[model samples]
Target: MTNILFVCTGNTCRSPMAQAIMQHRSEWNVQSAGIFAGEGADASQGTKEVLHAKGIPFLHQSQPVTDSLLEWADLVLTMTQNHRDLLKQQYQAATNKIYALKEYIDPDYEQAWTELKEAYAQLEDQKLVGKEMQADVIRKINKLEKKVQNVDISDPFGGNIMTYQKTYEELDNYLAQLVKKMENENR
Candidate 1:
């Protein structure tokens, strides 16, 4: 089973929407967290309204991204490349598993993985193998991943209901595409 973890600045907005969208649309296991710890982050009313409009049920409390969660996730799909970079820097070992959601769909991920292995092998050859170099390689891989073409889902935090609705629609569409891709990959 592919385990997916969605991340954003705060659990209050984008990530939560992604979590709910994925849960409803995909067969893969999914969860979400924030870069910053927010204890008891209930779903924002705007988020709720938007999901409700689409007939998707969601109720989420914000949780800080933890080391354990990182370890558990087979795939970490963040909202932005910066989020992926920051998390990989903090947890260098799992860099291979983390990706921006858009980047996850790219055909170039295989090439990125190849480059990462080569970078690590070079480090091993130089006897300079360390977590720092691992982290650096991860950063480079994530940069390459983000080079994959994708329209980022805009953050609708603190926006009006219309903005939330628009975001919801966009996320739902992406989630549908993602679900199909994941299913095909599984098959």
Candidate 2:
């Protein structure tokens, strides 16, 4: 089975929602992790409620991203550009396999990549640290954000239930298209 990993900032929401929704398809081996998940964390109430709305029952304990997970994942889909950037920096070996979830689903993914990369290259450097790191990273992220935000699935942590619902519906729409495209390609 193809191993697919979904990642986000916290495992309590986006990635778990993706995992649960995709698990229903029975096509690939799917798992989810967070870049900075606290140990033994449960899925947020918003996530559970959203999944339940679509008749998906998901019980997940949050886990942090690991080398093992990087190795196992055939394709890694991240929730946002920030998550993608972290994965690329931390797991350079898996750079070829990592993509933003929207990047994977969007028709103009390559153009988006090109534009984002060009903007990133125009930025001073990739590795900024200490106090300067915050400003530099924000600048770099902001540049790419303008070109790709139209396709990005927004993070809904700590928002109202409606916010969570919007996030879930967007994810579900893209995921449905993703599964369809994968099936067609495989066939």
Candidate closest to the true structure, highest lDDT: 2
The TM-scores, one per candidate, come to: 0.76, 0.80
For model 1, the stretches where C-alpha displacement exceeds 4 angstroms are: 108-151
- lDDT at position 160, candidate 2: 88
Question: Considering only N, C-alpha and C atoms within 3 Å, which residue pairs clash in candidate 1?
Answer: 41-62
Q: What is candidate 2's lDDT per residue for 121-158, written digit by digit as tens?
A: 64556554576766765676676677676555788899
Candidate 2: pairs in clash: none
Highest-scoring model, TM-score: 2
lDDT agreement of model 1 with the native: 0.81
Expressed as tens digits, the lDDT of each residue in 79-184 for candidate 1 is 8878888999999999998888766765665676677667657656765568897677667756754554343667898999999888887777767777888788
